[model samples]
Target: MIPFPESTLLVPRTLFGRGKITALPALGREFGPRGLLVYGASFRRSVAYGRLHDAARGLVEWAEWEHPGGEPTLDQADALRAAAQTARAGWIAAIGGGSVLDLGKTAAGLFHETAPTAAFHAGQTPRHAGIPFLAAPTTAGTGAEATPNAVLTDSNTALKKSIRDDRFMARAVILDGGLLSGSPAHVIAHAGMDAFTQALEAFISVKSNATSDALALTALGLIAAALPPVFAHADAPEADALMAGSHLAGIALAQARLGVIHGLAHPLGAFYHLPHGLVCALCLPAAIALNRTAMGDKYMRLSETVGGDFATVTNTLLATLQIQNPFKGQPLLRKNEILDQTLSSGSTMANPKRITPADVEFLLSRLFV
Candidate 1:
């Protein structure tokens, strides 16, 4: 029998279901009356927002800030911090997609610190504990709510990085599957693919422990079974499975770390302005092929877990979702720059297999149409 590895697992107190959003007001009161609500711009018109607003009425004093689209950036995080400070928020409630959640996490984590968000990105430790944070994720992807890290991009360098701390973990998380009904088909497809990639990579990561492995396997199975149906028809019964799977994948990666797929996805998304999930979808095949030799046993187990050959299953799913490599035939603006950035990523360091420069070149070659 394999021995359990030493690990530190952190997760929020979670309430998951179709109507879990209603519990937010009571959860918010745990921290204090005043809080900041960070959400996606599109969510302003969503029914989910109406439900949340109703729940907050007379229960909590909150200020709303809509996240301008795209990935969270340092400037955006700083702006959010400023808003929370101005509101004298005792907690932060993030309600939307990954970007909105990440912004909320960052703002809350940095609430008491006067240093710029970039300082934390540069490895500066925060001196004060942040306000309580609550997350209600609309999208099943990124698992940002379950994670203790918030990804933010440095606009000047166009490099994506993370502000990670155990304190950044949400105090409470509400995963309401009903919110997913409004997501576009493409959003579901890409986000589901990202969730799958996270599970797969964590399962095969060198750092994976027994806890991570178990969660990754369960997440992979759910994602494999749920993604297609959910993508084909929104509001599928399997939507909850996808949400749970995505959250589990996030938890798995938070402990086990990720691999080459995420390492490459970050640089690609940062430089090309590609959707993160799409980047993962595009890179999955090459990453799997590259890591196959090192992770043969894990791959076989994964294949068994998902009920088919891993490569064939993933390729078919990508095809069914109409997810193609957009980078194909598009010359990388700065090939060497991307290479350096990818190699320097924490995910790359955690990859199960050692990746050399030549291997990176070969992988990039395969991505071309």
Candidate 2:
């Protein structure tokens, strides 16, 4: 019999469906009347934005804050916290991609903290929870809504790290498939890969418990089936499946933690300014290969569930999405630099196999075309 693993599973009250975003106003009112609305810069131009505005009218007073777009920074988090304080916001609501959600979560968690956001990034413990937070993720990647960690880039060090706390968990999450209708094909591809990688990594993580393992397997199956179709045609019927899969992956990773793919992706993203999902995609095959011995049984199970071997499925997906190695033409950072960051990352510690600097160096060497 498998031994029971010690773990804690935390998730928001999730409202998932095609038009669930319309429920934001009613949900927002649960926290308070005045809310800080954080969203993507491009969302203001969408019909969904108008719908959200119409739903929120007279129900909740809100001040809109546009996400600067990209990975969130400490400065951005600080500014958002200040804005929320200035507005005297009773709650925070984010409706956009992962970056926007991370910013919103960070802002809400930091609103009452007097120290710099970097302090939290550097292991400062939060003494107080800011306010009720809600998230409506427009993208199917990152699953930021389900996580209690807000990943931000430290502007000073240019390194990506997370301020993790149970207080960062959303009070509620709105998953609307309708919001995904307008996503570009490349966005779908990149984000889908990120979700897929998260699921795979979580499944094989040493820290994975039974609950996370079950969720990760389900998520991986859905993602494997749904990502290609959605990537080829953004508004496909499979879009909702991909969205759900991504959310599940996020929850799985939140509990199970991730592996070498995320360990390497974080620093690579910091150094190269590449999209997070793209970085995961670039590192996945090599990471999988490195962990193959330790992960063989789990990988075989995943292959059966997903209807293809891990490497074959990943390569095919990469080809379908037209994702090539970003490190092909020029090296972004030295091997030692990548190795150092990889070794220091929390994800690396969760890897099923012991990862040495030599292993990371080998993985980096394979990332080049």
Top candidate (lDDT): 1
Error of 2 at 247 (Å): 0.7
Question: What does each candidate score in C-alpha RMSD?
Answer: 1.2, 1.4
What tens digits encode model 1's per-residue C-alpha lDDT throughout 1-369?
133546565654899898888888889998998888888866788877788778888888898899989988999999999999999999999988899999999999889999999999998988989999999888889989988899999999997888898899899998888778878999999899899999998888888888889999999999999999999876898999999999999998998899888888898899889899998998888888899999968889999988999999999999999997887899867889878878888898889899788777877888866
Our model 1 lands, by Cα RMSD against the true structure, at 1.2
Q: Candidate 1: which pairs clash?
A: none
lDDT of 2 at 281: 91
Distance from true position, residue 177, model 2, in Å?
1.3
**Candidate 2, after superposition: displacement of residue 286 in Å?**
1.3
lDDT of 2 by residue, 213-283 (tens): 89899999999898888877877888889889999999989888999989999988888888999989988
